[model samples]
Target: MSVAKLVDRENQENGGKDWIVEEFLAFSDDNRFDCSDVLFPQPYFELSNAFVSQDNKVSLKHLHKFLKKWYKDLAGVPWHDTHKADGGYYRYWSFEAACSVILLEINDDKELYDYLYYPKDLIAFYHSFNPTAGEENLLNKYNRIAIKAGEKAPQSGYWFTVASNNSRQYFNAGEILPEIKKQDWGEVYWQFEKEE
Candidate 1:
């Protein structure tokens, strides 16, 4: 019924979070990755400004893959690959950037990579939709596109498709954002405008 319960079930069915770490670690059961104590390391979690988009859908599998790579690559050692801005759950783009990185690592989908990793091309298209010329030409190019955060959006905006609602650009962008305030952040996130 709830996401946490679902995650717990997924873990039980598959393996505990730490157990998942054990497999990727260089250390075996004898000298496993010092992953016994995890700090829920500061990540770009978007629990606050995270609106259940009609387009983007996250599942247990998504969480599994995201943390699997994040812990292995980030927590495996002392150094991590993230920023303080990413820690702000209320901040929009930070979370998206984090998600983009995670998805990049796990999925490595060429097209998705281009969309999330490189926002320059996407921005060009978005702007072009206004008749503003771009570096390339292809009318329906702006259709069915999603940009996480990087070069295009100053902060981190998302471009989504909603058959009837038309394309949407989320102003707040964070993948692993955590809440700064109470449950208010969730509702507050909607007040902001979806800039194009």
Candidate 2:
């Protein structure tokens, strides 16, 4: 259910470019999730689009404006539930801001340094290592194990289908993999790449 909402959110936000979201939409029987209650500010999308533009100055201006507005309305946002007794686990976290900082490589932004929701430690942890290299290493270390779409996964780990773009996903042991509807590669087969 959560995966469905995530797919809807990403699809609305960025045309569903994320691989994980695409994978969920492809395999899940129930792919629809109600997001009518969700509150997505327009500025968030605008700020995201600004990053894709060639103008850094415009992007920075958008970032600054967004940060100011976001901080000003922090307590009013839907995810801001920290004041409630049972809200600790559901407390607001500025994931979007953290991602923006990382994507933009904005190391010297003083405003972000003081922002309460900015995940400095998380961003630092992300910057500490190259995760793509780690994934490549994992792929190289494991033997490529191929299985048909209807076959159950022999081991629980990450797998990729050569038939579709952004088809890499995780599967549990005994879970049946899915085939692409379009069959772009002439029958989908999943190839094992790594273990959880």
Candidate 3:
């Protein structure tokens, strides 16, 4: 089941506690998890949401509660990507996995680390499937390139270039630019082409 449905079902199973239910609704409606901003109102409420109650104090208490159940979900094989013969929505499992980690408690750093894919893996994954290299594809790759990262990531934003199969030379996601940065094997990075 989708995370939103699971959260809602659990809330129903627990009976209504006004505050708790309201908080869960608040999180479920939040823009952070809205994978498709285009689908407003109803669609936003049904998918891509999970309840961990990240607001203010007692977050860890809440995190512990979720960690208890998250393992069961994590242990299962991920919902892999699927393509439809007709022009329906394409499933991007790698991005979904990344989303799941970003919305978590970071309990076991190692386990959380395993949830996200490296830039190269994501690159190759998408590249293998792309049929038309168009504006949307560029935008998608641009968005992915920003979030795609290593396990022990340095900082938290987009870095346009990644070491493709080649050495010191890195490739931009859309072939529009060249990015060169100082990565001390596994530390400090600034931009497409900068060093410090």
Candidate 4:
């Protein structure tokens, strides 16, 4: 579902046709089960469509409505049967709904504050940190570099890490790239920043 959403977003950013979302809708139509005794509920099948729909505003509205009734909708699901031996300790959270909320940038929904399935903390953390923003900024600034940690330097040049303030250091060809350890930024990897 996340991959489909990313593809949809990429297509939208590049002004391309929404073929990925269309393919997903088509796949769902092709895999329809005739019987009513299916393991996955009908709502489960509709999740991807609601998440990665071409019309994001409408899809987000539908997603908000669906999340309101998510817990009640899963009343008779056979999810517990498969995990009975493990004491059914798994959390029954609507991860997809939370992900949709984050991806759609829907922040004004006050009703979702109380939804049990809604991962409020996760959403808060994602909004607060916005890890992708830094990466996107770096990509825009240094589009030529694509090297990562542990990779041998393709050629002798000055390299820098994306998520770190470390100065660009010169590296010899065939030298292994080094990583910077930082708590806030996670693993900072080297990228080709400039020529010698």
Candidate 5:
């Protein structure tokens, strides 16, 4: 009935070693990423985001494969690839970005949106979407907002798709983001107009 209870039941079924599900449970508790039982897609988003956020050390290829296996049918093929913002035009999304999309697409719940879009959380999630080293997109884009906010960037580049070497433009843009308040970064994050 409850997500925690459901997760506990899953843990029991897996002999307490279901790392993916366990990670999701841990994330849910840590981030307060909870939702009402009536919200079906919330569980899916929570589970996927938690799984993706668990380890930034994983290879981007593996991340793509995992997403494809679980999400391809509903979200489509592009959801399995790196986002256009990350220099790949395959319609992919980072874990947090995807969670943002899910909240909007699934229910448009502003409270949940604010929770997921908090600056600290956004920066962390952006970092978690790190790409593997030597991914040849030529023009890899890191989130300046994350770096400027004092969060650590992943050691490896956070990219998944390989674009043409000739058309690449490795520029460090997305800088000059809105200055958010310390206590209510989410409010600022929500109100800040994204410059495209």
Candidate 6:
């Protein structure tokens, strides 16, 4: 079954809560829905709209209670991304057999809810695209060069030059420009030129 349908079915089984149910769907909606790589007997999936309610708080408590009952050695996942818990979002994480479970809720209504499993094999995908400050510094220097070239030419294509080996290497800046704007070194690395 499709993940959305699976989620909707699970929601029905757990007593549906109000939200944009048909609007936004599962993260893997575009791909296959398999139980082997993820947690089975799927949990609740929601999108919190920041609607505050004592009932919602009770719901959050129940979700946590369920997780505690199921998993062991529960610990908070140290996330760097901006998540406003005080604004009414809560997060919980736990692990077993190199697979991790993440439970998240946003606002009192629990605007965004996700129960995701991070398998050991998938860690490389995240590592490939998470940027570092040192990489950002390097990009900044190259960005300046790219922007200067863009200003001078005012063309529709890459017109940048990198000084190297007493020579210049002309590279297409189109691919890397967006990563530069976002200051994302991981993307830059992913698209970096590979030696033949």
| Cα-based lDDT for every prediction | 0.34, 0.63, 0.36, 0.62, 0.36, 0.33
lDDT for model 2 comes to 0.63
Task: Compare candidates 5 and 6 on lDDT and give the better one.
Answer: 5
Best candidate, TM-score = 2
Best by lDDT: 2
Q: What ranges in model 4 sit over 4 Å off? A: 1-41, 45-61, 72-78, 81-88, 130-196
Over 46-162, each residue of candidate 5 has an lDDT whose tens digit, in order, gives 444434442433323333343444444334444444443566454323453344333323222223333322233444454456656655343343332222222232322221112
| CA shift of 191, model 3, Å | 7.8
Kindly list the per-residue Cα lDDT of model 6 for residues 59-157, writing each as its tens digit: 455445444343332223344222544443343332321121122222332221233432323333433466689988777655432232222322234
Q: What stretches of model 3 exceed 4 Å from their correct place?
A: 1-55, 78-196
Which clashing pairs does model 6 show?
A: 47-111, 47-112, 48-110, 48-111, 48-112, 49-111, 88-107
Model 5 regions lying over 4 Å from their true place: 10-17, 29-59, 71-196
**Candidate 3, residue 36: lDDT:** 28
Evaluated at residue 21, the lDDT of candidate 3 is: 34
**lDDT tens digits by residue: candidate 4, 1-196:** 3344445453445222333234333343553222323234435544544655667666766766777667667767677344446675676677767766665567654556777677778877777775478788876775665566878999888988767675579999899888667678854567777675
Against the hidden true structure, what lDDT does model 4 obtain?
0.62
The worst-scoring run of ten residues by lDDT in candidate 3 lies at 38-47
Per-prediction TM-score: 0.17, 0.45, 0.21, 0.38, 0.22, 0.22
Clashes of each: 16, 0, 1, 0, 4, 7
Ranked candidates, highest TM-score first: 2, 4, 6, 5, 3, 1
lDDT of 1 by residue, 42-95 (tens): 331322112222223443234334433433433443333343435623311223
lDDT assessment of candidate 3: 0.36
lDDT of 1 at 69: 43
